[model samples]
Target: MRWWRQLSVVLALLCGCATSPGGKPPPEGNGPPPPVPDTLPWTPCGRTAIPLGPAPEESDRGVPEMVDGERALFFVAEAGATGQGVWASRGTRGPGSCLVRVLSPGPTGLGPSEATRVGNRVFFAAEDPEHGRELWVSDGSAGGTRRVKDLWPGKTGSEPQSLLEYNGLLYFAASDPEHGRELWRSDGTDEGTVLVQDLDPGPEGTSPDRMTRGGDGALYFLAHFQGLSTVLMRSDGGPGAVELARVPSEGGILESLTTAGRRLFFVMGHLHDPEMHLMATEGGAPTLVSMFAQVGGMAALGGQLYFSATTGKAGTDAELWRSDGTEKGTQRVKDLRAGEAGSAPGGLTVMGNRLFFAADDGTHGRELWVSDGTESGTHLVMDLEPGAGSASPAELMVAQGNLFFSAEVTGRGREPWVSNGTAEGTVPLDELAPGALSSDPRRFVRAGEDVFFTAADGTGTRKLWALPLRPQGQCGASASWQALRRDVVTSAR
Candidate 1:
């Protein structure tokens, strides 16, 4: 398949719009929208809904990153017809109500950009058709976009991808004219962008691509030094990039990386022979932490690492697992019977004492499930109907003692859904405007008492949305705020 086609397929899965083998629409209506409010509340935070508009074409949008504090949202919006660009949305309510803007390219057309946020600024990379993908930044404030680096300017520069914030500087990976994929940094200034070091160092090698900050002050990533072999590397944002360990070339591919305490943990091996491995940040051999499991998603919460993994003879099912930095100590927390005949863990998040995840028990297609570190406590929070398949939960967040997520419902394509960890607490947020397709809640960042997210409109235009998270029963007795409502108007039409 073409790169654009692959990108579209990924987007369809991420956006919860799976098509049949012959390209027919999936099932419909997980459930009907909540009844309309009889009267508007003086302050209704529970009733707000946000929308994430449609794709530029039928292609896909992928890799959404939420800015801390929920001030903005960033993601790669790609179209087979228009290529790809980095898009930003300015609120949390849903897509229709927030202001949406596309970042400017550095004299060349932009394509396939990824973003990360630090403080009030959002940094990303966009293709400089002439110089390759370069680093850029945008202040969350209105009219604050600017290009940070063109790197090689005219020559084929490394594609600057994967923006990660560490120690007040933004670190990323890009191909340079002289070096393959090397580590680069930006100091929130236009002139500070430069190559930190090349992990590959020799010819025909690629440095680390996805740079993630570890619990220690150092940065950890993966690089392919020789042949098709990939290795793990660490850097302290200085000139030296240290090689930690080489992944087994035969069947090991490091899919994801994270850190807890002073240990660097990652998912290694293939889905067929999966294992979660860990290594000390001081540098040593990686030890297999878990076995015969395919890790789908992971997150760190309260010094423990929480992830979604599947374990079975055929490697067909999935469950939630948590670890306290020990091999024998690691164990399964929740099993949704995923990978059986047909089921899987969709998305995961760690908040307070609970691990929230999405799973399909066959009957509900896919719905939200939460576990409190006990098998008996594992239960479904939302039972989505067919058609509106709630495959995975995206943008899982905690706001004002409540849990919020984005999922597709029976009638809704993909919309924002929130829960208080119970059936009575789960409901769809109503859109602020009528006739808007409120779906794809990118991420929820807290800004004071309000939670913000990136959403799409009916026309498929992306924008930011916000909702004020108020204390329960504070909005008065007659006021019912069960659904999401929008906060911004779109300029598409």
Candidate 2:
């Protein structure tokens, strides 16, 4: 999988669903569905502002996992006397729909997490009194939710990490008494769930990690050895994984395993000595792309990989760059900040044909910027914070053809904002915290017609908030626009 899909998978793993003792029974009729308005509103999805986490204590609900295109499954953490487990929402059916608490907590709190869906079921890791923390699967029902297998046998759970689906099977990094922490795959059954390979053989397994899918539909990952080195390995669902390349332990830190432009890319060594490497899907020795003083976020568009980095050359200090999977083709797109300060472009998100990122052009602080893979086409989208003041837009996500992110305004604090890649179109979605307090909306995921996020409600506890995929108004105009207008009016008074 590419970076975006990989990120979505990781985010989806944080929440899950099951039937719980603390949950209320499903509501009666969902009430007549609200009349579809000309423009959508920034309305809360559940019947009430159900604070998954109690007051004064922020909710531990991370990212959500959507099922059946309507319900959202999330993990709630223990707070005070409250139990921790999985909770589900009754879709985007207006005020009548409410949240359903599923997956009862264990003695030490179930801590249900790393949930991913495959076929008709969702696979996740959770803990129970009888089985510590092990692999679990749920069909969105009380009876259907149960432990898949006790990989570790007892209280010491297998502790599965990096849950990924490849070839209709779920692959993860798990530890067992016999295999240590090796690669394991499952078909949602005890018998079908078994170790893929012993990589390192004995008790101390290879500790395979960063498992991701390539363009060719093969699994690629990094496996670490005791004190020797880390090897890049590829697997085609075969009996054994193939080692492609190795980096000595003292060589440098090998990280950022990404697939872009139909090629697998990674970085080895950095700051003083960094080398960007790429390997072809046809299989061969990895080729050195280029070296950088520093490298940050990366994304691919039109068969070209765009990233933020400094070329280690004079007057180059972390600017926007693009690569065609070659040393010569990799070059800086522009020096938005002029001199050596560089734009330091991050949050590289591909919305439509342009790349949106957070960058400082010296005069604009760190505001929203866009590029079409060219110097002339790349420029500041808007001075959201006005003079030198930064909106510092982050968490950029493309939803319903518009860019959604959390940005700060001088008086409004930090809140969610939506943009159409234009100066007039970029506007604050809502003053979620009211007044100047920031709700700090984040973890944006678009499922079905609504985009869900986690934010504070001025009560200090973060709760679920969502808005229509296509809202009406001047800047995502909706009933929420009135909130921002009210804030401005009050400020004028």
Candidate 3:
């Protein structure tokens, strides 16, 4: 069976679109000011919709990452004639931008995933009918592009994942008949790219995930063992990889691991008894940080850790909390949902001196909120959804000091939104699909003044798009498009 997945074209996805900023309801007699006249760096490249397979009905999912020293955005784009292959763009939002440089050509459709940059090269998991799926490397050119190794042999792919560069080696997980699915490393060579260890030993695989860095030499990750147990483990790209701790996972899972100030924090337990803990390594016993109802999204800001957790007590509610990695310093920032039902703040992100997230303050449904690590200062940015529902802003990210995310409007599905942490400043960046059609933007990558993300057309074909995040004057409606292209090309380049 082929491992590649195509978006279901016939499936109608009720998603959101991204409109321009400051698109709120104005005073009665007052009309909307003329649309901001200036260029957005958003360029549409490749086939907006794939031709060979089912297109994504909701989102195209263009995950733009820097290549060639951050000079351009490289991502997987599907074109009808070119099939699915790697593409590079200098932040061009125009159509067929994938033609700028077709990094990997697959007439039978190439599928790429787990892309990561190691120094000057981009390593990823790519699939061709002949090779199945294996490790490939590219230096943004045809001459430099080549296959690293075919670990699984043929017909069966090693299915490389958790690709990360640590201690001067590209470490990932691969599955062959011998090792099952264990740890593997590559120095961009066939012999150098051998099995790091068979942690699980035999057929039953111990799938290592995350591939996070712990300290000077090794990297920390999570791997599963016999009892379906999730364990905290570390590897130095060799047989020396050791299991740090075995989580008593009732549901056979360790929620998530996030790094903050030299410590790794995670949660454990089943639905009714989740606890958060902090660890310096996979070494000693982990220190219990909190015994909250549950800890979901978390982010580190200004040496303090912030996350959304529910207080499962009387009048229990979910709210934002912060800590100096101590129980004493840990407390709720604000009662967003108030009473028993939690506001359930998630998607914590940092911009400037504050952290922005999405939450439902009893009144305006689930909307955008920002905090300065204090309760009084934590407030809603605007009523994006307006009533008793959620605009549900997600994927909170920062680029050039501005916060960007995707959220739903009343009639719009989920669309891209940008904010400067003010009521008037928060608005949908563009109506990509417009009306009820959702563009469903994802994978925001910032380059200079522009923020790049992937979006699907109304037909659900994913492609690359960019938006100039910094404020600019109106070049007027007539000149805005041309001026934006020129300025963005200059600034981004």
The top-ranked prediction according to TM-score is: 2
Q: For residue 135, what is the lDDT in candidate 2?
A: 89
lDDT of 1 at 115: 59
Estimate, for each residue in 119-205, the C-alpha lDDT of model 2 and write its tens digit: 656788877776677888865444667899999876778878878888888999899888689999999999999899998888888
Which residue pairs collide in model 2, if any? 1-213, 13-114, 13-115, 472-477, 473-477
Question: In angstroms, how far off is 153's CA in candidate 3?
Answer: 1.5
lDDT of each: 0.57, 0.66, 0.61
Q: Give lDDT for model 2.
A: 0.66
| Model 1 Cα shift for residue 409 (angstroms) | 4.1
Model 1 steric clash total: 51
Q: What is the TM-score of each predicted model, taking all chains together?
A: 0.71, 0.81, 0.76
Per-residue CA lDDT of candidate 3, range 61-165, in tens? 443433322334445555446565555443322121332234344333446666677755678877766666788886655555678998878767788888888
